[model samples]
Target: MTDIRRIWFGSMSKTLREAPLTTPNARKGLREGVHWRGVSAEVHLGYRKGKRVGRWLVRWRLPDGRYKQDGLGAADDGLAADGVETLNFEQAKSKAARYVEQERQKQQDAGKAPIPTVREVVEAYAAGRKARAMKQEGARPDDAKGRLSQHVLSHPVAAKRLDVLTDEDLADWREGLGAELAVSTVRRIVNDFRAALNGLPARTLKRLPATYPMTVKLGLKVGEAEPAAARDGAALPDADIRRIIDAAKAVDKAEEWNGDLFLMVLVLAATGARFSQVSRMLVGDVQPVQSRLMVPTSRKGRGQKRSTHIATRVGADVIESLRPSIAGRRSADPLLERWRHRQEKAKPGARPEWVRDSRGPWKSPTEITRPWAAIIEKAGLPVDTVPYALRHSSIVRCLRAALPVRLVAQLHDTSDKMIERHYASAIVNALDDLTAAAVVPLVDAERGTVVSLRG
Candidate 1:
């Protein structure tokens, strides 16, 4: 049993009370429920004919002047049934007010257009970049798609609506990633995100977030020494280079390694060109008369063309060996063609021989890793050594031979600052030899003076 009270409903006053389901007055309405005037609606205590407990329901007027109804739960019974709790008269009134407010908000939201998600924007940007890359001639593979899918789209932040994205949300995501990724790698990914965001259509995103949380924050000043790993990898010693080259030659003789693989090692050791640059060289770029090799632009920079002299005898010899294979091809043809795979040779349309044909350029020098690793292992060199180490070794050789850093930088199409940073210790060692040549005579002269005095 519950007390009866008088309550106002919009403009009219009504009697409100809670009563048993069997009361004749409770069944007077067509809906068959004991209804009470609530804060924003008429709260009803209703029963289905066969149910033990009655449910609380609310009927309210929408902004459009249409009546809407919703069920809150069973009426207050003190005990919870099957994990469903009942609400009292006061609780029903509060719930009804909340229901009405929620309905109004839903209606307001329905009137506006939907916003894009972070993932949707990223995906659109990636698709656009991929399409542009495909349209360009000789475009390198676009890695942005893979990177965004793996690092950005997979993140929880991708679920956030684009319009509601804030700097704090981005900062939290960045901070979370900082625990697992290196600062440099995080900076690269963040820059990738910025690039993606900038690529979005002006109509889609009018402006970027105020703060880019993943920007590098190492506090490093200009001219500060970079971490050793950032500068370069370990340079191969002369002994290791010799051993590896000899092993590659032996492997070629044994028919386990391709002749081109051996020549690639020799050329890399001689010219100091990056793997990508060397892999993309065209036969016409080689000039035996001038002893120069015109290196094309690669993925390193914005594809700036550079020319480097093939001063080493080994480089000249390797170039001569490759001349026979490239003699008849057009100047635009790739110098190094992709080797025929063993499995491909057995295919129906396979070529009769494995000679270098005009099929096209090898996609990358990195594809030669299988044979390169075998040769390194056979030579007992460090297993961790990579193809880039050959370039480092070549540069260090020039430094040791007293070559000027300016000439080396010009040859490699890089800055003298880079050479000094990576090979400073080697340069210092070379200077010691120059200093010894001058100091040794002074020491000999002093020794002679001491002998003459003793005599």
Candidate 2:
């Protein structure tokens, strides 16, 4: 008994706005499109393959030739047969039907084109990026790009819109993908969406979610300082770190032609330094007096000109690991020159184009993920863990020891908030040890209810 009318400025049906299957007993083509107020509406049978099923599914073709479909499947009367639905027929379709009419009344009469949904926008954006990147470099992004798009952008969570993203939405998504995908999967999705927002030029960019909504849901982390930091793609643990290092050490030429891939990871694990820091460090950047390695400010992170500090433990490890090739070299030497030279040389020679420096430049952090990932897989470690996790692990260790996150962030060169969001509960166990160390002596030496402590 729903009112059905034709929507048109003239003789043409123009667009079918409300294609409603009003009742479980409704007949399509019996009533065709109906109108509410000045708007026209109708319901069309949605078909799947050869099966013509009657469900809540309807496509509202607005005036400007644009359309939006009701995803509700034909499972219920007047629903589509696709097995994908936003609403079920018998119960949800009628309610959905009302909106169809409302939309026509509000929009179609204006002769305006319909706006695209979140799914359409994301598809367009991703496809747009793919086209641009292909044309710009005549190639795809490095391997990290492969992992991200395949797992994060194209999977179940990809179509979620920024406005629709909720904590529950992300949490459910994180758990759903957790078993099938790597931790990096979620991280990469977050990064992809974030990059899409930040990197793409558009007025709608600001409306996107600034961080992965799951950051809070995955559990809190112990950062160098903050109460939260979002976890990333994946990171190797200490054992895997050791394994990767050993495998690299045993590679064909661990010496002379350094295994830049493994060595870079080792350096990140030990120093928690960002890729730019590890790559750009010159022999002279290492100061024995300060026990620090100074590199230029990175374009990533804070985006300011400042030095990144590599802790003594991490710094010493990198220096010792790289000592063989660098021992007799002068301060003018680049720390990573030899490795870069050897890697680029591994490919077939097209003849030498000398720019004076055999090691042309150190790689950015983003470029270092691929071969290191290969090394991890070869070493029988999880393929998901990447180099940045080294910094997180290092931060985790420091956090467990009750080292302040402020100090950790200061040392590691990232935000404290980023640390806390990603670190796991295992950090509590680490912190417990520090707490125990703090209290054990006090408990043992108590002369009164509480012993006086030295200032």
Candidate 3:
């Protein structure tokens, strides 16, 4: 009593005759639907045509008379979706079936609910989050939202929804990066992905802690070496220290007019400042004064509570040799220009362009460190060291010279906790010297010979 017809997309069609929902072809992308007389019950299913085909069908009725079955797109997607059950619409069908069966089992026993779809979590993360949070702040979307677009929402993973995401899928997306991206890059993406998924009810997204782990353990780091110990205050060993200084000097002497490499190592050894802090300074901060400029804004001095001066104790000789004269200019001006003029005059054979851009201007901290390690290698050092280690070297030098801890902490721009974490071993070694200082004989009475008792 109802009209039956075929709906065609491309060269294919779904008809009352060929619908998989009511036919054996229903195994994979086989289209079948039946139109009954006077009633609106119809069946439809799918067919996927590849080397190994897949079929899945769903049958449900609209409470209204507009009844039909669900496997429409799979039949013609043209691949044997069965080859990858987790990928096709047919896979979604199988997933829904398992979910339904599980829900029934739950109902018969105690009480539990089906995991919500990935689409559900996504909508909530978007509406309940991104949209409102960005607008409510009355600003454009911040970096979090920007990263979200790249990691999810716009990725295939987002298309599937959160509940359906497996650790494998996350790994695939991450590994697909063309080359080896930095750990920091992978870490950032995972951070954004987790924030989105975790916005769902805790019951929904499983192993939020485990997502980050999968990226490190399962995919990227399978054969990577374990990192050497890194503490906030770890110093470069003395040999490495000497190597870095030697490399800097050699590199400078080869191109004496340029202070870029020379001053970097000097600050590194003298202050134990991070490469970032040293490189960011204009020529002004590297003042050729007797003291290192422990700027409040410096990475090493960023969090200090008061004016803290770390005595570089480099002495007037080194200061006068390197200090830039301002021609009555303020200390606020950068120091590189003076080095540039001197380098040009000293290396009269070298062009300005040749020396100025050794690795280029406004070099990033990491950029400086990369070559620093190279220079150390050229200088014949066995171990690689970074700029921050110089800070560690400085700390040890101070402790060895016996500067006060509270003063060291303030100068280093960190709490004693950070210093203790990094320099505990060096500090421990200094204790023997401290004990020696305390052993001076405490004279008893005016006439008594110096009697050795616990002082």
Model 1 clashes, total count: 0
* Cα RMSDs, all models: 13.2, 11.3, 14.2
Using Cα atoms with residue i matched to residue i, what is each candidate's TM-score against the true structure?
0.60, 0.44, 0.45
Per-residue lDDT over 97-176 for candidate 3, one digit per residue giving the tens place of the 0 to 100 score: 54443333444434555555444554556565555544432122335555556555566765653334466776676666
Write candidate 1's Cα lDDT for 1-455 as tens digits: 55576654556676766444433334333243344443533434333321345566676665544556777776544344332356655565566665565555456556555556778878888888788767744455677888788888888988987545655656666665645766666666776777665555654443323222222121111122237453334788889888887887877667644566676776677677877667767778777766666765444544544533333334566667667657888888777664554322545776654554434455655566887888888898888888788888878887788888887776665779889877888888788877877863333474565332333
lDDT of 3 at 263: 64
Task: Report the C-alpha displacement of residue 389, candidate 1, in angstroms.
Answer: 1.0
- Top model by lDDT, which number? 1
Regions of candidate 3 where Cα sits further than 4 Å from its true position: 1-243, 255-257, 283-290, 296-314, 325-330, 337-361, 369-374, 440-455
TM match of model 3 to true structure = 0.45
lDDT of 2 by residue, 1-455 (tens): 33345554334665433333444344434343322222224334332221344433445565665556654444443444332353444344454455565455445335543333334545566777666555532132334445455545665555665444445554554455556654544566655544443343443433333343343333222113323444533444668667777765655253333455556566667676766566666677666555455643343543554543334444566666666645777786766653332323434657644333355435445555556665666678766666666766677666666777677666776667656666655455667777677764555354555656889
Which lDDT values do the candidates have, in the order given? 0.63, 0.52, 0.51
In candidate 3, position 154 carries an lDDT of 66
